[model samples]
Target: MPAPNAWVLTEGHAGMESQAVGLAEALGLTPEPRRLRARLPWDWLPGRLWPVPLMGVTTEQGPLAPPWPGVAISCGNVSAPVCAALRRRGVKAVHVQHPKMDPAAFDAVVAAVHDGITGPNVIVTRNALHRATPERLAAARAEWMPRFAHLPRPLVAVLVGGTNGRFRLDGEVGADVAERLAGMMERDKVGLYVTPSRRTGEDAKRALADRLVPLGAEIWDMQGENPYFGLLACADAIVVTCDSVSMMSEAVASSVPVFILDLPGKSRRIGEFIDMLVRDGRVRRFDGRLETWPVTPLDDTPAAAAEVKRRLGL
Candidate 1:
């Protein structure tokens, strides 16, 4: 018999993995994260085209043998096949993003509206799921407060995402961001908490530091401990780069106001998501102004998880 709980499938990307884990937690399930490993052309194949046996994994990776699980939450295109394989064994699969195949393959397909995936089973979410909750936020605040307390009040946390296919965080854009932020620091007298994503190359990182550090902003040197969660918990306002939906979702999910910084290119899905938040008054574009306003946090994880439970009858 399969396990009585839920399993989260991923290829090990942090953002994608977090969504699966987030949804699982919202469902009140302890997520058993399973990383999928494959090789060759088979590895590149879409879930629908994947062979029965799949690909390779070390013995230490655990037995994928029988008894998959009661429910499986999968993120990313590669993990779709793992979910599909489990579906063959009576596992209900909740897939995030366009499965890059038939929507009918899964019990429920959760996608962002911009993905243009529609079906009877498809549920659209304004943003990607995340593990931002009141409890987590409280813990983060408690743990991170004393460390950041010395910084001034009205903290502005800047979450910088690197480049995606549509847009790149090149030196030019980085300079523009630095200049704008320097202006904000000079005029607003607010302290900054800055952290760069992996996609944020050294050039962009240096650019931001050169401008923000001297102004008394606390920028993570990518060493020791990361203050990401603490910053989110403690920030009075948040500024996020537009290339990532996950970052924006986490920001707006906090009670603080979110300022979205526009990148050079465009992403239909990300754009639509941001527009929705803007209309809802949860977010605004960064215009060299740091403003704090009250609005309900944008939370979709719980509802999405509830839908999964109802559909799976768990």
Candidate 2:
């Protein structure tokens, strides 16, 4: 169970919510998740637009007035004002990611190195926080191991992400990715287990599937239960897209060898992060060659959580 006086707040964004929850669990807290929704035009404003409660949340879920909490973990720009408000009331507020507001507003801010945010209360990490602990992965492996038993040995997991502000997955890049995977299947004699994210459009998924399925690859089309964590658990190796730093981070954190596929983009942050990983031998770039090597799983979630706990004197 979580600490009675600790709460995790987010705008319900999946990535940010995961970070908050990961931190909460790291601190030995289960956390009561609080979702904040902005009221109309106020949602259009930036996180640092104004230093007030520009949004509103439903009161029907629980009593609006608070007895207040001793600790609050926040993520995303949408919850920046909430963290500020909590801090003003003497709550030990911990924020994840780069909030648009000043870092001084919170007791501690956990951000990624590529975000390039700096402040007295800031702690930087190489990867995003996630829920992919060894225990969870083991459970997922137990459940999914039988399901994938028919596939060949040396199963390669493909984690696909899609278009973002800085990158695209439409035409040339998609074709190139499919070709590379196909080449690997032909040469390496390994099986493939592919999963595409929500950001990955249907057309792009079909293109990749069309190329790989004939070669004995399986693609989870988001129909029933997701095999995401299961793939992370049982994969002999991982190939992930570069568009999502969060996804890449989670994959690299696992014991399996990780291969990052480059996309067409100008994201200096992602580039810098990948370079660091390559230098540290934590991961490799996919160049139509699939090689396996052992590496001390690259993870920073626990480190960030430890810092947050220290700051709060926990």
lDDT of 1 by residue, 109-190 (tens): 8887777899999888877889998899999999999998889878899999988798889887898999998888889988
| Candidate 1, pairs of clashing residues | none
> After superposition, which runs of candidate 1 have C-alpha atoms over 4 Å from their true positions?
1-5, 56-63
Query: lDDT by residue for model 2 over 272-302, one digit each (tens)?
Result: 8888889989999998778977788878988
**TM-score of decoy 2:** 0.91
| TM-scores, all models, native as reference | 0.92, 0.91
Give residue 128's error in model 2 in angstroms: 1.5
Report the Cα RMSD per candidate.
2.6, 2.4
- Looking at model 1, residue 199 earns an lDDT score of 78
